[model samples]
Target: MVLSFLALSACSRDFLDITPDGRTTLEEIFQDEKRTEAYLNRVYGSMPSYFWKYGFFDFLAPFSDEAYAYSGAALGWAAGMLTPTINPLHTPQERGKGVYHWGTFWAGIRDANVFLANVETANIPSPTNRERFRGEARLLRAFYFWELIKEYGPMPIVTEPFANDYDYTTLTRPTFEECVNFIASECDIVIGNSNLPMRITTEAERGRFTRAVAYAIKSQALLYNASPLWNPGNDKGRWTRAAEAAKQGVDALTAQGYALVGDYSNYFLSKTDISSAPGDRETIYEVHEPQIDPVFSIINSIPSKPGMFKVGATPTQELVDSYEMQATGEPVILGYQDEEHTQPIYNPASGYDPANPYVGRDPRFYATVWYNGAAYDNIGGEIHLMETYVGGADQLLVAPLGWAFTRTGYYLRKFIDPKLQSGQPEDTRWKKYRLAELYLNLAEAENEANGPTGLAYSAINTVRSRVHMPDLPQNLTQEQFRQRVRNERRVELAFEEQRFWDVRRWKILDQTDKLVTGMEITKEADHSFSYKRFVTEYRALWADKNLLMPIPLTDASIIPDFDLHQNPGY
Candidate 1:
């Protein structure tokens, strides 16, 4: 009997011991192509669930100034994340939890390593299939490592399964550059592989790794490596390399016939179902969950009215002000006059009417944010007007009833399918990488390398043209253009979990995450609404050490030399 049990459960700290079972041994598993494919699938299944579940917070927007949490206290991770109390011992669920299989991503890495080592020996009939499987395993390994680096900054890069007798404590983290090089090389392997198709055609293989996915990963990794957080020296060579890599990924995606599809708002609504015809062409990589009713995702972000799910995440006023006026394509508020932050310096060209605050704004703002008096379609095609003003239906002043309402006088409108009804089953995919992001990435990198070149403007304009927004103004200096690109990224990728990381990578967390503000709406007898912008008592704590998450305390405790190996200020 070849006992098949070398795989470690996700939570096991006894790294080398795999539970013994009566299943077939590694040899028998590899001999059968179907079993080997199943093993690879298991590795792919370890990818983190991007949606909210498993004690994880799905919307990272709250961590930034984009939003605030109404019911985040229900989840320990979410609650800890919003406060300054977060520590190495109680990091987000991305770090390992108590013994049971909860937050350990290393098990997935080990599985990928095992697959890479043995797949070459498997007796697969088709050489192309075998090579493709190998390519996928390599890409997965890179992805797992990327996840680690994204959180802990630098960590050990294990390429092979360890033996029981091997001393695990001897393992130490490599330099940041080494880890980057390792991940980049693995991506290159997948991209250069001939057996892997550029795009998977069979419906069953839709979510599998492909050449385009590899390029996307490569572009993201290069962009991170070139960021200010990682590149302290401000190397122009690094920025140039990142720009070239992003351009290559963009060019490859274009060659594969990828383009922005549908209206910006409609693209998200149409993605409610993968089976929806004329599938999203903008998606380069996405996490597809067909059986999941993604409508549950909006339960907390929506109004807490009758027949509605619970309200949780609420949009913040700071984010609302980021949107530009549609008429002038400029920010509604240019800047504040005083430190009290109550006075606003409105842009004369913006045509912003305080009486009708939400009108004449960027189309995307309407698509993304639900403000006072906004009409929302409920479960049965009934239109409900949001009354966020005082004593109104969704006002924050109604004691316990108002507890569920938005603190900022606005709710999330993006990603909620308006067509979805109560008790209806719907599915949504989180686009891990899309053409728009690549365009933004290319624009940022090009501006950094060559300083406001035509390539930079062209890349940014491509994204703007999709929403019918005007192109960036001409004759701006490099610094001015850089700020414009940064703002563009914030508005374009709001609530998509980009701002949380982007702020950190640019080392601007102090300015962006320091204070949060919300709008208080009052209704007069005439029924018109008056607004007061107040800085909320809630504030986000930021320090130099916050740029990278501390390594989990448990992992540090087990290591022989914790002091030298641990991330600083842990």
Candidate 2:
């Protein structure tokens, strides 16, 4: 067999970093239980990192209209992604903008296959231990497959490691249904294994794959399978299936005492530990970073005046407008009488004040966005107002047209720890899947299966109640309810890498990605603020072809018959 191995690094203290003097044999690895376990730990490291500072901070928000890339080089990927210029070979990876894990994930899949194929031979004393290890490998493999399908659509499923003489030319992409089935089957195998615990008990194995993780992945995959992109016939049966799967996952987690933790604003901040405390109950699965400072993520989003780089992704006015009025739970409807945006009209019922645009909005708006005159308590214990208006501090006009600053008169407040100091270590646990997302998934699936049922309302209301938002209207048509679910998901899951995929799956990308707008704030002579909503001139060109990312040109070139397998319009 042509076996490949990842060189284990000593950077992480949780996993063992075993270095062989030379090329190590499978016999040497499998004969020792610790070595076999180390191999699995390496696969765990491949889980995606949302905090890594590269191409627009690897945030999916900028690709959508949720935010805009202010930094020059970072803008390259965002700009390319929004236009037809984005080709397979010149993706975010080539531009040094974001972490494209298409290749990296495939390698992890190969490692998982190798471990599963040879794990039984390892010197594991207990049969239970062997089963748990095997189950963990299956879960990791399913996760990698889920990541692949989400990015590149249908993929060739390789369960066993290929032989040295295996032919690469014979490979062909599976049907989308087959890919989904393969992932579902892997999830079933992990869930059915009795040896796998519902949750990891040991602190040392805090982030290991568990039964809850398996169920969460299954729920997500099934939900995607029922989306418009995968279900072309608008199959009601697919929606029913998705609802059942999501409900099953949510019920299992809740039965295990999982629930929302803390307020909405504090849920994503750094936690002291991952123990099963009230504060940590919301996280289903997370990419845990231990005892390390999230400086890269924090510094990228912090204002330049706060003793750090100010260039980062800024929220757009379109996203700002999505936040509903706190008093009336209805979106503020704003209209411009002229192109200059000097004259503004607001929906009388929306209760939006042009003179004071940021007041009486959804509490999440204050928690997630840093707008003009928003106060922040600095690490040095000084409260400062974020002056994003023209000629004021953090101004867009002062910087040259391309310089890094707030282009939309707003900065991200979520996931940024106010207590962070220079050179101080801050640990952040990036929740990959949470209980709240499952609830949203269930609400969407139920509405599609059985339009605007009590089940759907209850599911969505659970999320709204967490932030103390009022419940959705009691009665509405199915279509109106659908819009409510979508808008709710957008507001609740903003900047957590959900909006980008949600828009695509919902098949509303063209409508949502049309034009990103910015709030042009000006300070009046009386120290009052004047807000003008103008198009940021950054428009995303979305077509049916953009539903699926193109297979990388490098991968296609090496294939014997690329034309048959390449995604349409690539």
- What TM-score number comes out for model 1? 0.88
Give stretches of model 2 more than 4 Å off: 1-8, 11-22, 56-58, 72-74, 81-98, 276-278, 290-297, 300-307, 334-348, 398-404, 422-425, 560-564
The most accurate candidate by lDDT is 2
Worst 10 residues of 1 by lDDT: 1-10
The digit string of per-residue lDDT tens for model 1 on 299-327 reads 43343332244455567787888888877
lDDT of 2 by residue, 71-166 (tens): 533465445453233432223531132155667688679878988998888877788888888898999999998988887888888999988789
The lowest-lDDT stretch of 10 consecutive residues in candidate 2 is 1-10
- Cα lDDT of all candidates, in order? 0.70, 0.72
